[model samples]
Target: MSSDRLRMYLFSSMLAAVTAIFAQIEIPLPLVPISGQTLAVGIAATILGSRYGAFSMVIYMMLGVIGLPVFAGFAGGAHIVAGPTGGYIVGFIAAAFFTGLFLEKTAFTYKMAIIANLIGMLVTLTFGTIWLKILLDLSWPAALAAGVTPFLAVGVIKALLAAWIGIAVRERLKSSQMSFGKAA
Candidate 1:
């Protein structure tokens, strides 16, 4: 394999490890337990962009699927993916992807950044709530109760924070680029 490919692989593995660590920091709500994993997801996207961000989450999920203790409460394996939170886990990838996509398309101003993170939260909620309904065979109302509604407030706050951080990083990168140009 090429050096670049090897580097990417190593980076992705590190992303997975970090994501798993973030996943463990949780506040168990009655419906969908709140976790810091989403923050990691946003950071991964903001730092790595869409492709690598998605790739990293894929690695994270694969590790969990292979029985690595890389999930909330140190849980992993098939049961985790097939359980109530499976959809949320899947949502993580989608959310990250959208966050990166939005940032790539628009200038990373504060408003745009907020919009991007909001998109990420919506991505998670939509996919997660749909899956939750199907997996549990619940009506729309019940499914929403089980999945989306309960987590709205916290999700918004998390999205806002992620958006702020993402924008800040982009701004810093831009400033650094300008400095390098001037130095050259």
Candidate 2:
């Protein structure tokens, strides 16, 4: 493969690994614990943009499905993907894609990143809440209480952090001429 293509692959893989690491950081809750996976997803999108960002999330999900203890609480396997939190896990792909796409269409500034990450957060919550409702046979209110309401404040915080840190790192990478490819 060409050098740039190789770099892109490497960066995607690295972000996948980063997501795995971030998954280990969690705040235990009754139904769905808050985890760093979303934060990592935001960062991946902020730094890698649409195609590769989503690709990285796919890689992360595949690894977890293959029983790589990469999900929250070091849990993994297809069972996890089909479990209560599965929707959120699956949502990472769309979150990353849309988040990066937003940035790609706009600018990679901190303000734009914040907006994109917030959108990504909402996407994830929507997926998780719906899945939670379906799987647990819960009412909309219950599902929102269990899956979405609990995550709002923390999700915003994580989004802000992702935007700030991702932009800083992306800027540094750009300065070093090692941004993997385009301004992703």
Candidate 3:
């Protein structure tokens, strides 16, 4: 592989590793534990674009599937994918994909970025709620209450942070690319 390809692979690997590490650091809440992994996912998409962003998430998931202790609370294994949170776990990939799609189509303004981030998180919540309801056999209202309602505040905050970080990364990447061209 070319040096650039190697660099990209290394960077993607780093992002995946860091994402798993960040997933472990969580603040336990009344309903669910909150982690910075979502923020990392969003930023990864913005920085790495759709292909690499999704690839990183795929790698992360694959690691978990193979029984790596890379998930929250060091939990991992294929069985985890069948748990109540499995939908959300699957949502993470969709979140990154949609987030990257938005980022690619729009200018990286604060408002635009935040909107993209919100949309991304919404996609995640949609899948998460569905999986949660099925896994728990919850009524619609109960599922909303258990999966979505309580997470609103935290989700908003995480979205904002993701947007901010994504925008910053976007700028940095732009400048870095420009510099690389100049050097070339």
Candidate 4:
């Protein structure tokens, strides 16, 4: 591979690792704990755009599936992905893809990132809520309560923080002429 492509792959791998680290930060809830995974997803998308961002999430999922302790509470394995939080984990892939796609189509500014992250947040919640409803045989209201309602405020906060940090870091990388930033 070309150096640029190598750099992109490396960065994608690094972001996956970062997501693993972020997963450790969580606030326990009844069904799903609020985690930094989504924030990491937003940041990955903002910094890497669609392709690499999604690649990172894929890497993360694969690691967890392979029994790596890369998920919340250091939990991992296929069972975890098949568990209550699995939908949210699966949603990370789509969230990163769409969030980066939005920024790629628009400007990678903080404002745009915020909007993209919001869209990503909704996408994740939708996936999780549906999965939760089906997995637990819960009513729509109960699913929403467990999967969506509790996350909105904190999600927004994380989105804003991700936007700010992502834009700042992206600009720095670009200014430094880093290969990953060029691809981003």
Each candidate's lDDT (Cα)? 0.78, 0.94, 0.77, 0.93
The digit string of per-residue lDDT tens for model 4 on 67-135 reads: 999999999999999989999999999999999989988999999999999999999999999999999
TM-score of each candidate structure, all chains considered together? 0.85, 0.97, 0.88, 0.97
Top candidate (lDDT): 2
- Ranking of predictions according to lDDT: 2, 4, 1, 3
Clashing pairs for predicted structure model 3, backbone only = none
lDDT of 3 by residue, 1-184 (tens): 6666666566668778978988898877544467777777877776666666777788888899899988777889988878876787788888878877786677666787788788888987898889888888989998888788877888899889888887786678677762211111
**lDDT assessment of candidate 3:** 0.77
What is the clash count for each candidate, in the order shown? 0, 0, 0, 0
Greater lDDT among 2 and 3 belongs to 2
Tens-place lDDT digits, model 1, residues 11-114:
55777788899899998976568887887777667655666677789999889999999988888998888888899889889988888788778755677767
lDDT of 2 at 79: 98
RMSD of each candidate relative to the true structure: 4.4, 1.1, 3.4, 1.2
Candidate 4 or 1, higher TM-score: 4
